[model samples]
Target: MEPVAENKRGLMPGGVAKRRFKLSAGDIIFSILNYIFFTLFTLICVFPFYYLFINTISDNELVRTGQIKWYPVGIHFNNYISLVNVNSLGTSVLVSVGRTILGTSFMVAASAFVGYLVTKKEMWGRRFIYRLFIVTMYFNAGLIPWYMNMSMLGLTNNFWGYVIPGIVAPFNIILVKTYIESIPSELEESAFIDGAGYLTIFTRIIWPLSKPILATIAIFGAVGHWNSFTDSMILMSGKPELYTLQYRLYIYLTSTSNLSALMNSGGSVNTSVLNSVLNARTVKLTVAMVTILPILLVYPFMQRYFIKGIMIGAVKG
Candidate 1:
């Protein structure tokens, strides 16, 4: 039997039956042992999430009374119910969604343009420019400088503060550049000879051909934006209305005496200390679900690109 390329119903190019990856007796035994170990590993990885799910929606009374330790003793909707009533939290979620979308779009566009430029042999100062961006990834400016810069830029208390800061990833630019380099240069040359400008070639040829890698970038940047809290925590001091969901949830969970005060911000009494713990748990779950859902949903579509991009990027200059 030939070792076949998946999705193509054919043998190896030479048509000789392809080499097979066969197992010896010891290999078979080890393979089985590895699978069993990995199965247990997988279960271990998922078990914590299962615990979180069950405990999050569990009755607080049951949890406090020690009737439930690892799983829900009684299911109740109040955990989610309490969360649904907070204006600041709701505002935060919307802001986070907006920030993720807005920041990702900006990142994609900027990275795309920069990546295209960096890939061109004709561009002067390309090496310098690429290095300039890449250096920041290794040595970041301190937090105080970043905060003061934001203040100087008047991004403080502004919704754009969170959305604008992270749009250009030097690493992402490199990834896109590498993937673009993998594309046959002849097509671009032909486009250039046919009177296509950089914008036209990029918009017409590169973008459509590069959707898979773009999707990969979108997933990366969007997850970063969605999970981000520290920047918003530092910068968005005055604007409760503009707080990202993660930051608001962090404060809600950590602020013990302020639960009632936070609850009152929305004119909702659903945040008493007893109920707030449950809310905190639900917030944890909600954040887990929300942060992951987009990546999970988009993953299937971009699987090929996700793999191909790495392969393409790995090729030496």
Candidate 2:
């Protein structure tokens, strides 16, 4: 008998034949088109930040003339170094970071607890309370009344002003509620049968299960708190110590004198050289980069949860 012919494709260690899979022509074309589309889309989204960064690091004179684009030219650290001269820089960073942490925590906790409470059939006036929350999303008193309320509550010029008002965000609560409703009710029932209290069920089972939505709301809260300067602008008018990073950046943008003073603070530098390489434009770009970098750094870590949470939470709503 003739020896059995060997397969052109070699067998695996387990003696399973390795199959070669080839993409169809349509699939290959579709994949190429998808890659091209996404590549262009990514570039579009990223160019603004890249443009800002390069302009900040590039020669201020060249940047001012609009010659610097797509890459750095005659790069120097002066733009960054000059930022140290802003007396409020360190305090503003601390205030922004502190508020982001505290505010996000408070918002997430409030959203989760309220979200969970509203889902229960046994909770008193759950429907009316939930409807009230929904109603807040559609209506608001004007800025004057809002400010008066804050002043009456004595939140004016207070750090808590940044955090407390954001605690009952109806939108976030709705997202959390929708997501929580998707959780299996059997899990809570089982916990209840085992002598678990409502608080225990929430802390142990519901909270852990709801991590995706919680993280989503956390990202929202963090971004909102980090980017918000209007509240600080209105409430902390006389209190520079409580001014957030965004508010400080706004002040710098609107005040060329402030930027000039900061640039001049670079000790012992030749006045002409400072004037040449450091200007309001470069300073503004550098400040923008600084303000946005933290959030950019943080968003990647939570992106998976963000997408998942938003998708699941939005499914019902």
Candidate 3:
């Protein structure tokens, strides 16, 4: 401890400190690029929501008077209140919810079972059958044929009309099959060695292992069913009584939006152009939120599965 390296010239008694100025050209370029992309994507994603939110709460005069509102403009929630306005929106929500649950369950369960069978090595030339299903996915039999088929079977305007025909999706089978392919064929063989029947192996092993793919399929199928407008429009056309949420909302917007025709096509009442939104644009947005929000909530949960599913397969079982 004689000198103890404790001289005053020893910057810290043991060592000297150093500072650095490090900024590579690549770093600076990436910094600028990151900021630019962040801003661009922010605007791109935000604008439509901004438009919807602002219009939803905006006063008609402000919107119609040429004052663009990038934010809330006086909070007129009456549109949402009225659209949801008690039992109407609630009932529509129920219809959509019911359809989504039943339809997705029907599709996932049925497609998964069929997918399991189709994926089996001993299924003996399942490729031709699978191809037939996939072909139907690309080339539909057209509206008239579909309508005629439904009519012949009396499914048109029936509740089954919504849940049955499209419940077993071909592409969903492919996705589940791909995931199933990742599973070990040895697992099934082992189960067979233990006297487990096909159903037992399917229910106990394949079903459990297939959850991720099933969840991914569930989200897609549920969203499809929830957002289904075309099917409802065609099948329930004359029977508005059976119209689903999207279909009913479309009908409401169409019937209500044209105020000019309703109030006499060419009359000059100088109140502002934004009043047009009142006709049914407001209703349309409200209904859209109603139909979409539940699925948006669903999205966060299944999103990981769907993302991973595109890349990975389960270990072959």
Candidate 4:
């Protein structure tokens, strides 16, 4: 006997047919254009790093003559060794690592605290305070005046220069403030009812919930501190020991046209290896990679938080 026809509709999960929306020709065209535009944009953004990476690893002759392209030509790792040969490499690394960790931590905490306080309607002169910070975003004192201020404050030649100046970033504060305002007011009210003080409510409830925004701002602070060269150049000019990695890298890049001269001039590692690979261009590319790798590595770990925080924090209170 022939089997009965199957009830295809009832057999499907949810027992309901999925509805499909037909797109207009215009919609399809718009989507296609959007994809094309973004693909090009992504390539534009990514190609520089790709070029830098390939050039750094490619043979010196290939990089100099513009022969290196999509892939590395003659694989060379000596550019990295040249970077390691610098005498102050260890010190610069320590300075950069220390400043990044300390500065980012302080900035995140202070900015969040200030942001939370500004969200409190009970606070007096809150509008004025907020406006004061916002105004700084648009205007700044000239370089001379700023340098003089740092000099007067004795921040010159000091490690605190890196950490202190960034502790209360106005933009990060605004981001946190907007995000905090988005949080339900009843949460704070309920905490108050349970006899939670402002500090307790902040540490226990606000801080925990504010992780996404904090991580985003922490990334900003870390990148800023890590890549900061001008600050060290200006503030620690007299103190070579206080020089950061970026500052040292800056000096290396600008100090000479000849890679061999620059490498042989100071640094403890006067190896034949560095001498063999003495391609200034590739060496600079290697240094660039070293400088950016930490931040790039960090992005993958914090990417989820960053995307979520930016989207949510952008919402108006």
User: TM-scores for all candidates?
Assistant: 0.80, 0.87, 0.80, 0.83
lDDT of 4: 0.86
Tell me the alpha-carbon RMSD of every candidate: 6.7, 5.6, 6.5, 5.3
Candidate 3 Cα misplacement greater than 4 A, ranges = 1-25, 64-68, 84-88, 256-279, 313-317
Q: Write the per-residue lDDT of candidate 3 for residues 96-132, one digit (tens) a residue.
A: 7788899999999998899899987779789898899
Question: lDDT for every model?
Answer: 0.77, 0.88, 0.77, 0.86
Ranking by lDDT: 2, 4, 1, 3
Residue lDDT tens for model 1, 7-93: 354455656554568779999999899999999999998787676667657776665455665667778866566667765777887
lDDT against true structure, model 3? 0.77
Superposition error at 281 for model 4 (Å): 3.5
Query: How many Å off is the CA of 148 in candidate 2?
Result: 0.7
For 1-317, candidate 2 gives per-residue lDDT tens digits of: 96555455676656788677899999999999999999999999999999998898888889878998778999899989988876778899999999999999989999999999999999999999999999988899989999999999999999999989999999999999999999999999998999999899989999999998999999989999999999999999979999998887787666756545766787455666546445655777888899899889999999999899999999997
Error of 4 at 301 (Å): 2.2
| Candidate 1's TM-score | 0.80
Candidate number with greatest TM-score:
2
lDDT of 3 at 37: 97
Sorted by TM-score (best first), the order is 2, 4, 3, 1
